[model samples]
Target: MPRNYASLADQSVFPSISDLPGDYTCPETGGGVFGCLLVEIVSIERITRLVLRTFDRADSPVTVAFYTGDRGRSIENDPKLKPGNTMAILFPRRHLFLDGTVGVRQEHYGYFKV
Candidate 1:
């Protein structure tokens, strides 16, 4: 992921959480990069990686997961990742999981700003 991925991303082509395709039951690859999403974090789960449940600007429920491959174990205890704080997901893949939930799955670094 580039540092300026979000700034270079075209919003019309790659939209926000609210504009994601409803029929996408599986993961699609034209990943979007949101510079910043001032979401309301609901919970924080850290076992092997960092997972956050949040509500986006449209009040749509979402899950943001950062794999530990890039975000080391120390990120689990980061103070900035607490519930209610803002997080940014850049160049992340949009995933509609089997549970019928929409989310951003970041499998690498340089894509998250917490």
Candidate 2:
């Protein structure tokens, strides 16, 4: 039980692809209509890696589990990678993805005192 992404580092806990909104609802036709969903997440060192693709135009595959804080555990037993909106570079702080081109795929390693 040791997961500390430096306590989420000021917490802007990432996810993108415009949050992938395409009339998403169909817990198996309880309401029906679900299509076009792709996820990608890649965080290094403190480890937040995920990749998920959810589609329903006869392309079936959806199994997701991810968590890092707030009693975070049971992302399918620490699931590692797949959930993408796509963007990577977490070094010396310079990130900008102001809606649509997706974001969040960070990688930074050590030494910061400012």
Candidate 3:
């Protein structure tokens, strides 16, 4: 069963993307470096899909979505999902190609229960 989106709270924070390693590189065939940070789940919504927005201490937001399936259940049941608790997220760094095209690598970071 789908969890109620109303159960989520609205608290925001700023994620420090700049703190991520700059030396991290992506592969030519396509895979990007991983960037990790501590964030709080601010808001959640279910509109045909599940959406979660996390924030850093500074109130910066990073939003992600999960479609129906095992992945969706995982997102809903994530242990770090409390409204105020801090959870670490690992995401891929944005890649800028020499050809002047920008891309983001798709990857999902799991949470460790604290």
Best by TM-score: 1
Better of 2 and 3 by lDDT: 3
Arrange candidates, best TM-score first: 1, 3, 2
Q: Give the TM-score of candidate 1.
A: 0.64
Error of 1 at 89 (Å): 1.1
Deviation of model 2 at 69, angstroms? 12
Q: Which is the winner by TM-score between candidate 1 and candidate 2? A: 1
* TM agreement with the true structure for every prediction: 0.64, 0.21, 0.47
C-alpha lDDT (0 to 100) for residue 85 of candidate 1? 81
lDDT of 2 by residue, 27-67 (tens): 47543322222333333222343322332112322222222
lDDT of 3 at 20: 38
Model 2 misplaced regions, further than 4 Å: 1-16, 22-33, 44-71, 76-79, 82-114
Clashes of 2: 14
Off by over 4 Å in 3: 1-15, 18-33, 67-71, 78-80, 94-114
> Per-residue lDDT tens digits of candidate 1, residues 41-106?
789877656778888766788887765565556677777877878776654445776667788766
| Pairs that collide, model 1 | none
